[model samples]
Target: MTEHQDAQGQHAPTTPPAEPAVKSAGPSPEMLELAGRMFDAARTGDVDTLEAYIVAGLNPDLQNGKGDTFLTLAAYHDQPAVVEMLIRVGADVEKANDRGQRPLTCATFKGDAASMRLLLAAGADPDAGTPSARQTAQMFGGERVAAVLDEAR
Candidate 1:
């Protein structure tokens, strides 16, 4: 046993008891709620709110439970402003979800030619994910987007 000075500066035979280690309980409710809001922003084209969150240290690449990212939701909903903002803020354009779907696939599936073009311009892989953007376009009647993807190649 080592002697230590106490509060009164007197030598004591024992040291103060060590603090207990704090156990993690994972993300708090507030954080989960905030994440839900951010996902909603992405899905609803709330570019201002999403931008604010991203600016306030929120990771733009944070994926949801099933691995779908902000960019995926934005592209899926044809939110041009949100997509552009996510791309400019370093979101992964080629990231695939748990279901092996990418942002480009979402845009292609909906035949959102504008979104497909934007994603392609941002380096989104047309051939990425389980159903490649090309395959998705073909399967979903997105001939226009398919043509755009071809042109991008």
Candidate 2:
């Protein structure tokens, strides 16, 4: 037995007791309500309502449960006009969702050349890293998107 052994000859290990798990502080009620309204606005393509909400101090970069921004939702739902509006209101076009898909990637994946054009013209980075909008366009066989991105290079 070591010199630090108990009288009974068993070595005693010294360590502090661990702390109990603490409760996580989730989103507030107001943030939740605002996020729901933002989702509805994006889904319904209600530009007026969305503008009002943004003007009233709602975040333009608000995301849903899937970590999809309003711009991503607008693009996925084929609401090009709403996408434009959100971009004008300062939405992050290059923002990725949980799947690492940006708004441009969603539009390109859907083969919506017009939407892709708009986003590209707005300075959305086509060369963003892996699973990028440009790569998604190529993967989805969007010849027009590839041509356009190539031209931009």
Candidate 3:
């Protein structure tokens, strides 16, 4: 317990030295590969692969760097089953991307009536985010989509 002396020769209580900072191991190669595969599954509407990953503890609402969630990708790709599965697993129905586009809006823009219906059934807000699903349907001249949106309202 040696005393520490100040510049003025005043005795000061010694303090314990700080431990060295530990470096993070970061994501392993396997983790990186798995993440890539998961994103691919979402984009390609591979429901089984996505389901397996989710069951293995991957977040159902995992987003890419652009903030596009798995649900958003599935909806944009016109995959109603994948959208339904994601919604069933508790994915956010109103999660907006960086551009403020929701899954419902993406489905409407793509004229995917089935996906639009699925999103609406899962309680998605037709008016959520910029350029809402209703607005998108109107812009895309999807009369069926507009009718569904009206019915859901």
Which ten-residue region of model 1 has the weakest summed lDDT? 137-146
Provide the TM-score for each candidate, comma-separated: 0.84, 0.73, 0.84
Question: Can you list the residue pairs that collide in candidate 1?
Answer: none
Model 1 TM-score is 0.84
Q: Residues 11-42, candidate 2, lDDT per residue (tens digit)?
A: 78755656668766799899788788878788
Scored by lDDT, the top model is 1
Candidate 1: Cα lDDT at 73: 96
What is the lDDT, from 0 to 100, of the residue 31 in candidate 2?
77
Q: What is the C-alpha lDDT profile of model 1 across 1-153, one tens digit per residue?
A: 689898999998986778779978899999999999999999999999999989999999999999999999998998988999998999999999999999999988877778788889988888889999988888884566679899798
Candidate 1 vs 3: which has more lDDT = 1
Scored by Cα lDDT, where does model 3 land? 0.87
